[model samples]
Target chain A: MNLAQPIYARVKDHILAQIRSGALVAGSRVPSENELVSQFSISRMTANRALRELTADGFLSRVPGVGTFVREATPRTSLIELRNIADEIASRGHHYSSRIEDLREMMATPNLIDDFELRATTPLYHIAIVHEENGMPVQFEDRYVNPFCAPNFLKQDFSHQTPTAYLLSLLPAEELEHNVEAILPDANQQRRLKISSSEPCLSLHRRTWSGGHVVTSATLIYPASRYALYSRTSLGKQTS
Target chain B: MNLAQPIYARVKDHILAQIRSGALVAGSRVPSENELVSQFSISRMTANRALRELTADGFLSRVPGVGTFVREATPRTSLIELRNIADEIASRGHHYSSRIEDLREMMATPNLIDDFELRATTPLYHIAIVHEENGMPVQFEDRYVNPFCAPNFLKQDFSHQTPTAYLLSLLPAEELEHNVEAILPDANQQRRLKISSSEPCLSLHRRTWSGGHVVTSATLIYPASRYALYSRTSLGKQTS
Candidate 1:
């Protein structure tokens, strides 16, 4: 018992230590404020504050008219990050490999005008690569790049480095946007990913910008069973 | 032309006008830097800079040996904002409705011990709701609440307000987390959402925290064809 600390804090710490030490397990009733005042020779307000603070902190739960009990532990807050697929697999201690299916410089079409903001006949490089982890096909990537951003895109040796890695090395994305959809794989996607038609796939379309220019627009499809996305956002400043 | 501005900016604005006015149509070639230098009596470097900056801003594309042509318009930068579902529907000018499938108090299970970090016997409030737009089922919501956070969760009249609205009114989430996956709905989910088994669904699991305590954990399921998620993230400060 640190005498320098406030009386309420000392009481809270004592209860916390008991809970941490497994003496007060989850859902087990905690000492009532009256019981705490009698046991510790403290005022009712001091005992009440300790329990109230603990309840608000998730260390305990208060059932009105019933009793306060130890709360269950909650999940830790997640960290949301946008990372390259190859690096993601590597960090998992798995080998990353890719097979390039197609690479070409094609004229942009009308529909692509919306995605790339380029006129038709504008030369854009398109590439398709199947990313594998531990010999299993996990993602199929289809991408279109503005040739002005990566003039040597089609000529790069992708077997040694992924396109995402190459792009990041040259022009790092200053802005990123994602449109996610739940999809049933098309026959071509199923064949490339080796998935059944019934299996749902996560299709993530990502666009990156660098130096105020659209760098790349890419679609990566992953089998849902193999991958899930986690994102954490701060809402502390929002009012409505 | 504004003579006070740099000569290069004047030339760039001239070309931008033609492009924006439909005189220089999409895929049409722009005057070469040499032509611009001679035509405007400007320095070659100035002409070069004007074209280079235009290309970088997605106004034109240079096809190496070919020539610089107007580029397609790219999608505008997206703003990522989190919003409530009922509000989202109302903003679309659609009538929002809901059916409360089940609302009860239950004991936490061993598996949920990881999610809520509570003992198995910890009491939690559970609710299942089917959300409709114009009488068509669109989403199935299942949620578990910490009784300490919302003791009246099961007693609320969901017909007038969503559980999300009720919770947000009492406790504003300081931190929000999401786990998104593509899935085929189980029989119960399918029946509740009134969807075919073959249809794909987007499953979004969300958890919110307020005052350092977990407020609620919810799973929202939407049909893939009917819903998609958009998120924009800033990557300016990231190095790796």
Candidate 2:
């Protein structure tokens, strides 16, 4: 390491330690360029480098004319991992269960054909389930399965085990596509989740594929106040 | 195509078309199982299946005692795609420009070493640039670069091109990890973005790597009222 390396790192570490120690809370402004230079006995250029880098990494916020300040951190959740809702709930030490709202074997429409990549008028299975954590409804899962992927889907009862678990056990996929977002809940969701009309909902949309076949596609909705998604990634790891 | 397939698909398509066409607006209650059964002239089981699947797909919301309603169609935005803010502004026919608030080269700390998977005390470059659209500040971009990835990072001028565009030209990676969430902007962000304290901000966190080398990581913050993320996916093919 060069002589300048230690000085630069110490300054960066000092700022991060203050953040972790809560000496600097979210939205609180930090010292100016001149102040940092004087405090660290470093050149103005080096002080500027530390603050600028921190801002880019999301630890600090900078505005022109105004000084820099600490930033509130947002949870970084991964969408690629295909985890079951029941398992996710159970992992948190909460009792998890699902109520089978509806289930049936049916034929596909043009859209379903397109969505599931099925031949015209192919047979498919549909299921509706509300997964609960600690007796509270947390996820409304609606899913469609290509019958070819799980021929005996309707024979299995979902009350004891979720469709996700059953399918993951029966067939596992190598590739998956995931999408997630938030929006206002509708009257029905508001009532079913026991939330009000004003509450927002976090929604997840996912599709799984294996061997050039579409296994299943599902949309899961949750009351925002009750649920959150989380994920972690190493630096330079492409997350798609 | 089997007889059951057309019936299953028509009902699903009709409902989605209605929602997309705005015939069924957000928050409006959808027809009941009984109503759908009568309108579609299919078995009650078929109508039930359609509504059940739609609800699971996030196109509808259902309550036990109340009724089913159209879910607010919130678009899911993919974080993996690196979007250019300036291009986004230009697409909207607005003039976009950026001001270089701070830019300098520095040495990496322990955290950076772990994050970028680098040896202790490596040299790195850091840059902070606030992007504006039509004279209104919209994004605060903070970035860190592994000098090993882009040796001449500091030599490039950012007054004209964003670091994102610059990096994209230098290293194109096959994989990406992206995280998006809502947060309260700090005092510095509020001042630079010209947003009031009452408004929330949407934060997009991204980390990109190529061939196991950490290129860059960034967190882009935008005021909530002005921005929303959008994404879509499809089930392409079914394989047995």
Top TM-score prediction, candidate number: 1
By TM-score, how accurate is candidate 1? 0.66
The candidate 1 chain B region of ten consecutive residues with least summed lDDT is B73-82
Per-candidate interface C-alpha RMSD? 10.5, 11.9
Name the candidate that leads on lDDT: 1
Residue B41, candidate 2: how far off, in angstroms? 81
CA lDDT, candidate 2, residue B36: 85
Q: What DockQ does candidate 2 have relative to the true complex?
A: 0.04
| CAPRI classification of candidate 1 | acceptable
Give every candidate's TM-score on chain A: 0.65, 0.64
Residue B11 of model 1, lDDT score? 86
State chain A's TM-score for model 2: 0.64
Tens digits of per-residue lDDT for model 2, A1-240: 566666756787788878766687889888888898999788987787788768756688887788999886542234545567776665344678878877998788788888887667877899988888879998888799978888999999888888888988887665566656555567867766777655556567777776678889887876655655543332122222
**Model 1 misplacement above 4 A:** A1-80, A234-236, B1-82
Docking class of 2: incorrect
User: B2-97, model 1: which lDDT tens digit per residue?
Assistant: 237678778877887787567887789999988998899988888987897677556788887787898654322222344667888999999999
lDDT tens digits by residue: candidate 2, B1-240: 123546866887787767755788889888888888888778887787788767755678899989999875433223345767888899999999988877888888787776676646777789888898888888888788878778888999888778988888887653345656545567988888888765655566667775446788777776766665544333232222
